[model samples]
Target: MELTCFKAYDIRGELGTELNTDIAYRIGRAFATFLKPKKVVVGWDVRETSPELKDAFAQGVLDFGADVIDLGLCGTEEVYFGTKFLNADGGCMVTASHNPINYNGMKMVRDEAKPISRDTGLADIRKMAETETYSEKAATPGTLTQLDNRAAYVEHLMGYIEFETLKPMKIVVNAGNGAAGPSLDAIEAALKEKGAPIEFIKINHEPDGTFPNGIPNPLLHEQQPVTGKAVKEYGADLGVAWDGDFDRCFLWDEDANFIEGYYIVGLLAEAFLVKQPGAKIVYDPRLTWNTQEIVEANGGEAIQSVSGHAFIKEKMRAEDAVYGGEMSAHHYFKDFAYADSGMIPWLLVVDLLSRKQTTLKTLVEQRMAMYPSPGEINSKVADADEAMARVYDAYKGDAIAEDRVDGLSLEFADWRFNLRKSNTEPVIRLNVETRGDKDLMDEKTQDLLALIRQ
Candidate 1:
């Protein structure tokens, strides 16, 4: 049984080498059998393989006597929106999410956008897919219906944000040949219809599966410079870039400087808390000092959970968290069925900045200065576990408190560091933060890397 397709959150791999139509079909059958859904909502990105996988998965679902509502060529969030708004029993999105062109994957959600992760049912789905023991009896397969939920998705999402008082601002958007182009058009039209002064200077706004420009992965340092350059070249108020599937967005300031998701988490947390004071904000423990301070200062509660979408969304649901953010750029909102949105966070930030009459840089400058991070540093080591153990041993004496929750976290008086091995790769991720001290941040980051490298 090939289990390599079973990722931490969803099923993903190369199209023909690892993930094929047969695998998708089997996984679809397993999903319907496990969840026992009457109807499923399916969506896909602009990747060439997306439609093929969608059809194969839908066939698997139909084979199990379950219907499928296909939202063709939509963002992952649209799938979530369709699942909840259309009242489907389950949802699946076919996207590689900023990976290379040869890669493709699927993201599943139980009823109403509830994520299906390894801890949830991803492992079971993998097991079932591996066994290849699909149902023998052919029941009355359900039919597939095409639905254009783009307008409805945009409308419902815009309703969450109020642009009535927003001032005219030139925003730069770098779609990077992903699915964000059409969605941005819808948003612009809606704002225009409402007579809002929001204007977007769009670049790479066309959706091309070939990705003529480059891969739409803003998380990569190399891919981020394009948006930053656009922000500076156009002199726009700010810049926003999305991944391949448009599920995660990266922001650039007026100076074309990339704004860390850490700061954006605090910024968005403050925005949401200002509206609903005393609301709960969920965050991952990997990076939190600023987020904690911001949330507490705004009269909101901060709940720290383990890193990853599954954990964050689950805690958000349990605590009724108004917002949840991870340092890795994933932002979740309660309004969106406690699911993460690559669109809403940027929209809210734009709305917040326009209404405040301040630039995105000006708004986040203080917080950025207050909490200087070492930026996430990743190193490919022969033994990630040994490197982590070495760091733990080296810091065990000087650390004030140590927690091995998601990774190895050591807290000191003025600084803290987290060193964790990646679940998907052979490298460990290290994130260090100092109390507004760059030199200290540099020193600690270097010291930790030295230890890891040794």
Candidate 2:
């Protein structure tokens, strides 16, 4: 039994062929056997298969004598929150995130919401699941309990921003028909109770597993325009969109411009630094100039971590970072058990808008101008290594410095680019940035794309 569903960081597979209730049960049993957890937290997204899978996984835990605390119908971060909040020994979230409609997956974590990446304990879980070897069952099975922590979680989120500072604003929130709808509704109710004077114009805000609209991934250039158009039509102060599981969030400006996640990183770094000066900020290596400058200029320390949620969380714990952000829209906070949250970023951004008396565009425009980037570009190729080799060979002579922290990063005086092969696909991603030269950035992006696709 080779578990083809196990990936580098989590579990993901298509229906019937790779994953089903049986495999999910085995995984739950294996998870319990490996961790010997006294209690486990479980949650699932809006995927049609997710409820059955969650029940199967929870049964495995119960059979192994570990109690289950089920937080029904929630996002991935909610499991992270529940694990730490309930003092559970481990947690699992049944969610495929931004994957296709036919796909489903699970993300696991240990006590205190620590991630279970391949290096930590995922490999051992996979092996145990494949072998189907389990410890003896207890005489009496563990009990199952249902808990709704939405109110507590919303309070925790609201703690990140001051209600008094929030001004009158109209915003568009597109849930893309995923699990975020219910949670967003809870937050909206909380805001109204406090008289926050914020108007939310919702779109595709139902939890439909069929995804009546396309999959809820705003990272796709084509999917972004829907939210952007809504922002313009509503005359919104800003717009926010989330993926299926709502772990990563994308933003749009007042004029309906899609703001790249790179610029948001800089904006957020400055926000944190303003309150807690001299704090450490962890950032991914894909786009560096803007984040580096902002962190340094604001009297904060900037640290670079290899891309990925597990790696970023590990680095944040080691460095005791105040915040960590990836160019792909993942933002982590220290107070949130070092877990990434799609909900926190927007709240904090809106709070900043009210406090600074500025718009999202104004806050990020100067930084965007200072460090121009075309965002991340992915190219599918026959050989990822060969494509990278060709790009490196073409620019090695003129490169002043090179860093291979997560991938290949070449830096010159005015511009730099990072090229890395995708972990889960036969594609290579390229990110290029220049110092205040959009034309140069565009030219280099085109040059690199030609080389990568050739």
What TM-scores do the predictions have?
Answer: 0.98, 0.99
lDDT against true structure, model 2 = 0.94
Tens digits of per-residue lDDT for model 1 on 1-454?
A: 6868879898889878899898899999988888888889999999988899999999999998889999988899999989999999999999998888998999999998999999889888888878976565345888899999988888887876677768777888988889989989998998888887877999999999999988898888887888888877878888999998888998998899899999999999999988999999999878889999999999999998999989988899999999999999999989899888889988899788866888898988888888899679999999998998888888899999888778988999999988888998899999999889989999989999999988
> Candidate 1's C-alpha lDDT?
0.89
Those runs of model 1 whose alpha carbons end farther than 4 Å from true positions after fitting are none
lDDT of each: 0.89, 0.94
lDDT of 2 by residue, 65-111 (tens): 99999999999999999999999999999999999999999999999
Worst 10 residues of 1 by lDDT: 132-141
Q: How many backbone clashes does candidate 1 have?
A: 0
Most accurate candidate by lDDT: 2
